[model samples]
Target: MITCQDILELQLDGVELIAGEEGLDHPVTWTYMVQTRPFAEHMNQGNFALCVIDYVRYDFEEAQRAMEELYELGISGFAVSVMEDREWIPQKMIDRANELALPLFYIRWEGASFVDIAQSVGKIILEHEIQNKRTGDYLYNLLFGYDINDRYIEKISSQFGINFTNPCRVGIIVADRRYGINLEQDEHIYEYYANYLN
Candidate 1:
């Protein structure tokens, strides 16, 4: 999974983790540039939010409230750009983020642009998805390839780091339409289950 730690490794200019170091493993499914209040309503779980401290008007109370709301919403992490004059995030906000284990990041106002951070994160996510698709294709071929042979199986298994010698079982999922489910909306859930099963 693409995670907060992975984003940190990109080392975008002037961005640093300030609190909740233990939460660096939080999976980041998407990134958002937040510039408005009540932004939590537009966010979803696994979202990494980026914004300026101006979102809270540099008020400690507003910052606290925003962090609390983001935590409750399962936001993966937060990155706030501090204005030159301010130069710091509120201590109370940092304390609250540690308590919630929600990774909090700091960005120098004149450092990385929000667009750059968002695009970098987006690229990482896309690359991860592409790799997953390629792995899936390899597995599909293993299951159905007409010319399967010991050498071919060994090559595929070694390439993907799978232990082909281990006992394995296959499962079949049959979806019923009696309840009229929204396939599009539930597609991610299916992917989650597939990964879990694998």
Candidate 2:
């Protein structure tokens, strides 16, 4: 549930907003900093991509293309550091980002460290993960009767967003090792297992 707006509110190292105001609400699941080529293929949905254009001379055209490619790859936003040439990012790139509604940020290389931004975003992601794990553990305990009571069940279920009124069933499956069937190799394994359970 961490969004670009949350990062902006952090006011990380006085980071400046460049464009894409409409995408402030876009959800960010993770943050990645890249200075190398071929970045988009490695990214995931809801990723916040940070471009470090650190070379003595930078190619604005390639940077623009990469931004568009990252946006198409489903990134929530993009951040870039100022080039060595002292040129603010080009107006066309800002216009393109605005047109695409992909949030853009300008963090000067001297003004902020990548570690600072990463740590701030990483904290939010880690907290969400920890909360999810806690919810899962609570559900497991309740289902297995670690503490079984109407009050406890209702409270725990609501906390984890589980609707107890809905009919539910628990299932367990033991895979046979003798067959040497690799689930990854066999597309039919899921159907076979379902048929066996039924």
Which is the leading candidate under TM-score?
A: 1
- lDDT tens per residue, model 2, 3-108: 8998898898848788999999987877876555566445666778888665543367777877887787788999988654367888999999999888999988
**Against the unseen true structure, what C-alpha lDDT does each candidate score?**
0.77, 0.75
Give candidate 1's TM-score.
0.81
Each model's backbone clash number: 0, 0
lDDT of 1: 0.77
**TM-score on alpha carbons, each prediction:** 0.81, 0.69
TM-score of 2: 0.69
Candidate 1 residue lDDT tens string, 1-198 = 789999999999988999999999998878876646677446656789886666346455665677677777788998887656375787888888898888999888788888889999989988877777778888888778797888878887787777678787877665433332555435644554444334
* lDDT, model 2, position 144: 82
